[model samples]
Each structure stands twice: as C-alpha cells, then as structure tokens.
Target: MSSSAHSDVAPIVVSDVVKRFDKVTALDHVSLSVLRGETFGLIGPNGSGKTTLIRMLLGLGRPTSGNISVLGRKMPSRQVASRIGYMTQSSALYNELSIRENLAFFGTLYGLRGRRLKERIAATLSLVELAARADSPIQTLSGGMRQRVSLGCALIHEPELIFLDEPTVGIDPELRLAFWEYFAQLNQRGVTLVVSTHHLDEAARCNRLGLLRFGRLLAADSPDALRARSGQQDFEQAFLYFAQQAETAEAGEPTPAAEKEA
Candidate 1:
C-alpha cells in the first residue's frame, strides 16, 4: 500500500490472535482494531493478557496462532519499530542517570540526534511536568516522578503509535489525572495510544475500550455503550455483566440478553 493509504488504515489490527506458553494460554482467539488518533483502552484485571497483547503489538513477541498488523505492517516488523513507542509496566529507565539523560538515551535509540534530541528532551520534560526536575537522578525521584520521566522517554521520539502497559499503576490520583491529561494532548495531536489499564474509571477516558477477561475480549466498544448494553450505569457492574455473559456462553448456555434477541 502507498504510504498515504497505509496511514489511512487502522494503526493496529489483531485477528484471532492466540498466545501460549506451553499449556498456558495468555491470549485466546482475540481480535480488535484500534482506530487512528484514538486512545484505545484494554480494560481488565491483572493476568488478563493486557501486557501479552501489548508485547505482540509492539513486535516484541509473536502470537502462537493468528496474526497482528501494526501500522500496516505484519507482526515483528522492524520497518515500523521506529514509528511505535512503548512504556513498559516496569521501570526501564537507568536509575543512575538524570531524567534528561534518560530521555536523551532513549531518543538516541530511536535515531534522534544532537539538536533534534535536545529539542525533544526539553519538550517531553515540559509535557510530563518534569522540567523542573530534569537534572535530578532517577533513583532520587519519587515513584510518580519516575513514572513521568518514563513517559517522557517513551514520547521522546514522537511516535505515531504508543503502547502503555498500566502506566498509572501505583501512582497518586493527582498524578494519574495529570498523566491522562498528557495522554489527551497526545490524542489531540493525532497519536494513537493503546493503554492497558485495570482501573475502570480511567478506562472511561479512552475513546473506546476492550473489556478483557481470562485472555478473552468480552466486548469492545465505548464505555457508555458497554454500560448501556449491560444496563448498568456503573462501570464495574457493567464489566461484571459481560463477564457473566461470557461465562454463560462458555458453558453452552445462552445469556438472557441473547435469548431475548432470538
């Protein structure tokens, strides 16, 4: 496809993807498409395969079965690596380095250099609200501060797509709100974000959400749509409704809602 046409396609497409490690299934027949310039949330509890799916999307791992296309390229495509950003659940930063140094280092890995690198570092620091602490060593920063720096590093290269695995985990509510604000700005700038988060409240901020459970996607739609479908105004209650429906289907019983449609 031509570059322009490719840009018009969905940034992420996972088709019947299954990931396994020996007998353990991390992902099971999952499929979803993430639209361009939208924040797509993977909403599920821990061990629900959010991280596994993100890894596959980032080309760090391949599905045992089925396929994944990122930025119009197949799984594990090096050609699209530079165009994607990933903020891991764990700390991937150098504790000994200053925040500025960490951003510069990661930016260099993305082929940023000299003047451009310096500019990005400055811009990212301000974006994450860490400009004042840019000279502080990572080890000396608080957990929330460190998280901000990690986000800066991920965004230093200004990628078209980004995958954040539980980016707000362990942070204060105030900082979490700040992070989401930064994410909103990114979306406004046409960056596609795939964020895996267990926080149901945070999931509401995304343009759309995929409710995952036991490595299976129960439903993919807007938060309001999910709530409306489940007849629950509460997000948590809505998720439970879907979970129950999935369980019923697995047991070869049709859900009441399904029976009503028949």
Candidate 2:
C-alpha cells in the first residue's frame, strides 16, 4: 500500500519530530502515529519529555525539528487545528464562567453557534455525566468534576482528533475510570485520541503506546507486544525494562538491576 493510504486511517502522523529547550534536547527525533478511532497512549514517568512532545503536537510549542500532521494536514495550521480538541494537564477554564458558558465559548472558537452549539453542549455534558451540573460555575466544581467539564469543553466542536495531556492527574480513581470509559465509548464511534498518562493500567487500554524517556521515544508498540518482548507480566514492567535498556545504551553501562543481580 502507498504511504498515503496509511494516513487515511491514521489521523495523526509524527515524522522524526524533534523538540529542544535551550540547553536540553527535550525530544530526540521522536516519531509515532495514532490511527483514527484508536486510543493511542504516550506513557512515561515525570520529565520524560512526554509533555514537551505533547505541546509540540498541540501547537503550544513549535518543534525545534521535524513534522507532525493531524487529520491529514500539517499541524500549527488553522485548517487542520479546527478539527482537533485539546485538554491540558492544567485546567484551562475560566473560573467565573459557568460550565455551559465555558463550552459555548470554546465551541464558538471552533465555529459552532446557534442550535448546533446547544446540541453539542448537551451531548458533551451528558457524555461526561455532568448534565445536571451544567449550570454550575466552573470554580465550584470539584477537581474531578472540573476535569469532566474540561473534557466536555474539548468536545464542544466534535473534533476528529483529541489530545489529552495528563488529564486524569489529581482525579479520584473512580472518576478516572469513568473518564476512560467515556474515551473508549468515543473511540467506538470513530473519534481518534492521543492520551498521555502515568497510569500503567490505564495505558494498557490503548491500542498502542509510546514509551518516552528524556525527550526520546524509547519504545513504541502494542501493549502486549512490549510486554512479551520484555518478558514482563504487565505494561509497567515492560516500560521500566525498556527505559533501563535505553538508559544503558546511552550511558554505555549495564542496567542497575542487571548489575545488582550479577
């Protein structure tokens, strides 16, 4: 199949994307892709350059080198960006705005208005199961509720691709599960997703995951394939094993665990 055929099914394409921060090269030639309707995950510990890569993809940070295309269009462009929704690690909401108002504002930015806008708001609130609290001021909502609202705001325009960066951090476990369940439901209906998370169990739900370390793409594979290759029983072990390998390769030394066992 021609290379273009792949992008038709995969809404996200990262081709040798590199990002640097003055003295630190945050992302070292990172490359990956997320297929349409699939839950693609970026997993790694804190400071693994996961957030940096995410910012680059979302147009919050320009890539120092390389390219990222979303929805078959090059990123940081108005044409391609309209069809994408984004939720950052931090709450990106106006505290004084009501939940419904927040969605409407973001929806308007995506060119949604009138009856169409109203329908989208209700749909998002319902999907996040926050319909009853739609009128609540954003500042009054609990952390988890605020996250749901944040998520709802992202969905107001019905974007083809969604970027969620550490969206579940500080969220209660029960609500976290619910939020993921909502993501799975969206995927079932053909919405593409790229989620960055620290929860290994949650990361396993993704069709494929990219493990990052020090602004580098360490391993990118199906959860099962990664586990099998690393002789691990869970995704966490698979990730740690690969991270250690990457570090060893860079440092030209044995993995600490390997040295200890020896």
In candidate 2, how many Å is residue 130 off?
1.4
Q: Write the per-residue lDDT of candidate 1 for residues 1-262, one digit (tens) a residue.
A: 3275255689888888889989999988888899989999999998999999999898888899998988988888788888889999986899999999999899999999999999999999989988898999999999999888888888999998999999999999999999999999999999999999999989789999998888888899988888899999889999999999888877785532221100
> How does each model score on lDDT?
0.88, 0.82
After superposition, the stretches of candidate 2 with alpha carbons farther than 4 Å from their true spots are: 1-9, 251-262
Instruction: Provide the lowest-lDDT 10-residue window in model 1.
Output: 253-262
Backbone clashes in model 2: 1
Please count the clashing residue pairs in each candidate, in the order shown: 0, 1
Q: Poorest 10 consecutive residues of model 2 by lDDT?
A: 253-262
TM-score of 1: 0.94
Give per-residue CA lDDT, model 2, range 24-79, as digits (tens).
88887777877779888889889988888877777776888898876665767666
